[model samples]
Target: MIRDNQKSQRIFWSCILPEPLIAKYGLSFAACNFSFNLMSGGGFDKVYSSLPVYVGGEMDSDAFADERFELVYDKLRKRGGVFQKLAVLKEQWMIFRKIPRGAFVWLYNLNILNALLFVLLKVFRPSVQLNIIVLDFTPVKKGWGANSVFLRLINMAHGRICLASSPLFKSQNSVVLPGVVPQSKEEIPVISNPKASFLLSGVLLKEISQIELVLKVFAKLPQCELHITGTKGDEILLEHYAAIYNNIHWHGQLPFANYLELMHSVTFQLSTRDINYPENECNFPSKIIEALLHNRAIVSTIHYPQLNGLNYFEVPSDEEGLINRIQEICELSKSDMYTYVNQGARVREIFNTEIWNRQMAKLEANK
Candidate 1:
């Protein structure tokens, strides 16, 4: 869409990105975000300071309210009360202040604000090229459909600025980036042993009450130890279900290195979601991908349709169905079990940095 090749462009992002990877695409980037904590944690300072878009420090609720940014969040949360509606006009004030006209911005999360902002750019600042990279699509709230006007507007605005990070996203406007998976330093020993461990990683969510069903099933697997990882979410509700089980271990959150190291040792992985969507535009359990990379089998729900052809044990997100499938996976033959480890090469076959570069090349073509 950028017909004028003579103009210069820089990437301005508001999300965590792989610094070294995104660096090759543009000369610099600006990390402008509204965070509640200092950006000092991790290598964020080094990554953000490497560009001009970094917004110095975190922005609390007061700072967000000062610019009526709270309204945008309210809209996303689907809970804009009487007070929020009165300040809708002030949303523009926030936009113009944060994003200058005629700027090139690569927004990481295409939330409620960015949808309206994209429209405003088209109407007010035609020169500003807005690209959106979608890594997460787990709706601000459950039951969110892609047909919504805000999401439709974003899809309409895509002209080389939309990149999908997962196959779950299906719009002509976007292309899924073959995301980077951590490569083991050496050949990792694949779990050929049946009497081994199980790993479940992610923040526990209320909508995902199916996790309790998984725990119940895990309790039955006396020979296998279940390891849960990641920060956030309430695991206490399932404590009663797990208390009777000695094989269940709550590892909480581990460093990136430690998580993957543990992932490689697990016998199989579990990915389940209690809720179903009318649309398939939601994230698959990333644990499936991790299990695949480590050459382990997986027990998953329908959310991960890519593994439909593979040897994974698929079940409904219900208590009885989960127990049945978990038991089925436990009873697989040596050939069938090994097939689960060898099958499902889709991620490696299609998703890679090259696919990402090729998609970015479409934008670079105009440049």
Candidate 2:
């Protein structure tokens, strides 16, 4: 239903690439994060910051609500029911019918809406380039079929798949693209408070009980404090823990700037998950990278391949192991702390956003 003038030239780069690249090329991006706002600096912010971002989703908001967002949500809303299905079938013909074709069209996720959109984009604008960046194939609880089918459809469309992890490349059209960060370090004062505070970040509900086990272990550490960085007011855990533990402090969800600033003040960053779940085991926690970027020592569970031996305590499923590790970290000498911080710095450099951008540029050129 929406068609652009053929002669009005444009290049569509999909995926949440760095904002600098988007500004440099004057490219438009399709927004995929569930939220319409561009606050978080990871996926959605990277795209929404640069291009004429298309905000297509189940959510609704006034397109002109704030010039800061510059959004275009609900492109497919009731209009996409059956007519869109027909358009997908007649994709190539639709491209032939369109006026001046686009240079390239980028897609991020491969869900129901995206699959239909890709088909229509191909059919109506066959002459344009097609690039796809896959952050995750399926939802955390969902299995591989959703992703597998999406990759197959992408291959059929002649679009290339870019990934941040290895599991995304089961298809021929898939290409591995490393995720990046623009992290700089400062000499942080050692958190020498005898009561060492461990700041835990994430929505607590996903794995609340596992976190409770962690809390149980630390409760016994008389000289330790626990600061939880997520779950805004009225969480069940907040009410329950407040009564039981005098040492645990729930700061709720702080703005990212404040979160990073708070990270500098904490003694160590902590993450825990139930590895019995396949999805949890395979996940790459962004917080881990954030902690590393700040040159903070970590206490996290052993899950992903990249987490091996980075001074992160290999937490066992039981409470005793967690307790023992915390005790060991509590007694570490200044030299031991320095070695751990140095190791975290090495990992942080590998994920620097600037380094990631340069690598992506090279890959794009060679392709």
Candidate 3:
């Protein structure tokens, strides 16, 4: 039953609910992103919606969150185990039955033909808004199985499209609503020897092979204490780095709140991603911004165009260049660290909350 005059009442925060939104508005979320890590941010538990919530992904297991549908037919194979798979399928059926009529269905990276078919079915139904928060445009290309013509047609049915970065929105129909980062004027605790402490976070996706390079660089810099976080990849490259470099400590994926807590303990930070993925070029790593917000100096590749004024040191995609950059930072005087701090303050504005709030309000007003 579609409400003919549905109130502009719901926000349908369909993607991973950022902490700021829950802290500010406390709106309900759809929690429809690909990974569990994306949804574990601050103040998440407090924002409970009586409205229906739907999560669509490869596995139907409720292991991620409360409500979700399985996109894959055999989410559990012999490799994954039979008992585990049957449990997942049962959970999927239950979640499918509970989907609310007027709820929002969000898609982060949907390239599957079956996923699109489900979206089309929802569009034809009386209710349900197809809101999308476009992260990157890689999936719609040829190899990803996303038929270009079909994607364009389905894109037409979207009730609203919010882009993570300005470059992501090529068509005039989309508007930018980059994720928000809070400004902090409070004194940040300083490491006794700022150059000696280092932090690393973000998904250990295969594209991030640069982490191995950074680990090798840090191995040579004995003074630096490298703290690496996030789940291990199948490759386990970090294990090799650890065996070779005893100083490289692996603190596997921490909960969102705990991760922020750990940031306070380190002085310098790392956000290295390989340039191989086209997505890496335009997309800003939210973890890097979080480090900036917490007043940590960053060492990352020269990828994101917006990281220009920050206290960031970028090197070539080789180990030698990365080693030299790390050495240069370690050799800088205490006064130099302060200089970097001042530079970091300027970088904070790139993802300011006030700017995002105002931009989002303007878009809503026009609608």
Residue-by-residue lDDT tens digits, candidate 2, 156-245: 544443434444344444455323344435564444432366788765644522667766776787678887776423466665775678
Estimate the TM-score for candidate 1: 0.63
Task: Estimate, for each residue in 1-367, the C-alpha lDDT of model 3 and write its tens digit.
Answer: 1223434322222323333332222222212221222223221111112111222224323323544212223333323445444534443343334445655444443333224334443655446554444544443434535545434543654533443444334454455543445444656554455656788776666565466667767888887888888754533777677667777877775655677678887887777777777656434566666577677777777555455455566667688887777777888899877755434455446655455434433434443
Per-residue lDDT of candidate 1, residues 1-367 (tens digit)? 1224424343333433333322332321122211111122111111111111222222233433332112122231123354344333344345445555555555555554355556777777777676665544554354556435545554544443322234333455555441334322445556656545677776565344255666777777787688887544565744655577788887765655677787877777776665465222454444565567567777667534344445676677767777676776777787667767743345445433344434554653443
Instruction: Decide which is better by lDDT, 1 or 3.
Output: 3
Each prediction's TM-score versus the true structure = 0.63, 0.65, 0.64
Using TM-score as the measure, which candidate wins? 2
RMSD of 3: 7.9
- Judge candidate 1 against the unseen true structure and give its global Cα lDDT, from 0 to 1: 0.50
Number of the candidate with higher TM-score, 2 or 3? 2
